[model samples]
Target: MKNSNIKNIIFDLGDVILNIDVPVASLSFAKLSGREQAEILTLFKENDLFRQFETGLLDEASFRNLIRKLVDSPDWTDEMIDTAWNSLLLDMPVERVELLKTLRSKYRLFLLSNTSSIHITQVNKILEAATGIKNLDELFDKVYLSYEMGIMKPDPEIYLQVLKEQNIKAEETLFLDDNSDNIKSAAKLGIDTILVQKPVTILEYLKDYAV
Candidate 1:
């Protein structure tokens, strides 16, 4: 397909622009819960707990309870869980913020992330300190977080919602996300997408995609 139809841009937060370290998060949680990483991760996936949290099926407190239940440990406190989960939002890439800003001036830029309160709180605080940006509110034309939207990426509905809210056609939106599944899901709806690999920033990707 041609780039002629592209008008809006939607971005995924973690790992794409925010630089999530999955290893760090897993190791941190493993240490906190005093369990083997494999064991905890097994339960996390098996229970669909991660999906539930990202997709907004569970709130912060409930997610903590779910983790505590998995560990069967009374030591799993709120601070401990928050610390572990927030490890993923390690830092924001400076070049990415610049790229987003440049794109915002051109396209109707939006952020659609599958994130929860614990990480979102830390990300906002860090961005304020790092870039002096007000917060999520000042960042994009609209910010659609899964915890608030009741939908997450890899689901077509979430992308549809973005298009619907912006009153833009799927053909007119280009989605930038780190996950291949998410890219494919958006592509299924005829939306342009770029699957980001490490060490390549958004600026480089957009140079090829943006007309």
Candidate 2:
């Protein structure tokens, strides 16, 4: 399908623009929790705490308390917990930001990320430290965070809400995400989508569209 009608672009944060290392997080959490890395990974997949934290259902203090309980260690400091939790956020590629800068002139750009407070904080810090940009605000017209919106990707409501708030039509909007489920959900809503895959960055995938 031709996406020449797509004028607004919605970009996913993790794995699309920023690199994520889930195994690194598991290893880091394992160090603090005294559990095996495999066990920690399993817990991360099976536990509702992670999803709750992402959707803002659990406050930072409560999330930390839950983590403490899960690890069976109440004495761990907030910093330590944050360190382990943030291990998954690796880095944001400068090339991706440069591409966004180029595309901003051609498309109405927005950021739609499913992330929590801790992860967002770390992402901002990494961006500022590496590129001298405090956050993605300058790169995007609007930023919609799942934690702040109390919604996440793969949910039809979030896409509909973005379209309504941005005053854009679904057929005119393009959504790029690394996850297939997210792409499928957006596609179901009639939004053009590109499933960002490994070995091919967003720039590589949308090279023709941006021009």
Candidate 3:
């Protein structure tokens, strides 16, 4: 059964709805650069380039250029870079799509993801292929992308902006994300949250509501 007090639901894209493997992408990049996967993963953690790209501080071309420099592969093409970067995005399960469709009928649904333009494009393609949905906009009442909004999650400003724009109360909203930091931030704002961790997807977590 749905939470009676919750009128809105905000969903995180990666790991929550869309399946992603960060190490898979790192491995792909590593193969291309002849570096160990651990080295690539460490680079991702230590560098702010990804955060900059997610927040729209870097354009696609500039982001690609920076990636080339980081991997020390100046000859890598845009297609190659995008392919390696996009390897993390796996698939959107059809059942998750069905769950969203069912929930949409009863609540205001929203997509709030910290992602770049490149990932969004590929995700939409994945969505289209899986469920014939044109885009995530069709699944959610509103979509707040980090690249479009100039803000990222775990930041109070981003959560506040969504609440302000949607005219929704924090206490009446439910947020689901795979990241504990993100769940903590939302909880601090008085929004109910579920940390969608391994062995328990949003589908499994909200099975009663789906029923």
lDDT of 3 by residue, 1-211 (tens): 4577988999999999999997788899999999999998788778887899999999999999988888889999999999998999999999999999998998899999999999999999999999999799999999999999998999999999999999999999999999999999999999999999987788888776666
Worst ten in a row by lDDT for model 1: 202-211
Candidate 3 global lDDT: 0.92
Models sorted by lDDT, best on top: 3, 2, 1
Candidate achieving the largest lDDT: 3
Off by over 4 Å in 1: 1-4, 208-211
How far does residue 93 in candidate 1 sit from its true spot (Å)? 1.6
Please list the residue runs of candidate 3 whose C-alpha ends up more than 4 Å from where it truly belongs after superposition.
none
Clashing pairs in 3: none
lDDT of 3 at 110: 97
Instruction: List TM-scores for all candidates, in order.
Output: 0.92, 0.95, 0.96
Every candidate's lDDT = 0.83, 0.89, 0.92
Task: Give candidate 2 misplaced runs (Cα > 4 Å).
Answer: none
lDDT of 2 by residue, 1-211 (tens): 3478989999999899999976787799898777898887777667787789999999899988988877788999999999998999988889888899899999999999999999988999998877889987878999999989998888999999999998999999999999899999999999999999988888788888767
Give one digit per residue, the lDDT tens place, for model 1 in 1-211.
3376777888889877787887677777788767888887888889998789887899888999998888887677798888888886778867778777777777888898988877888998888877888587687999999988887788899888888878998888888899999999999999988888888877777874444
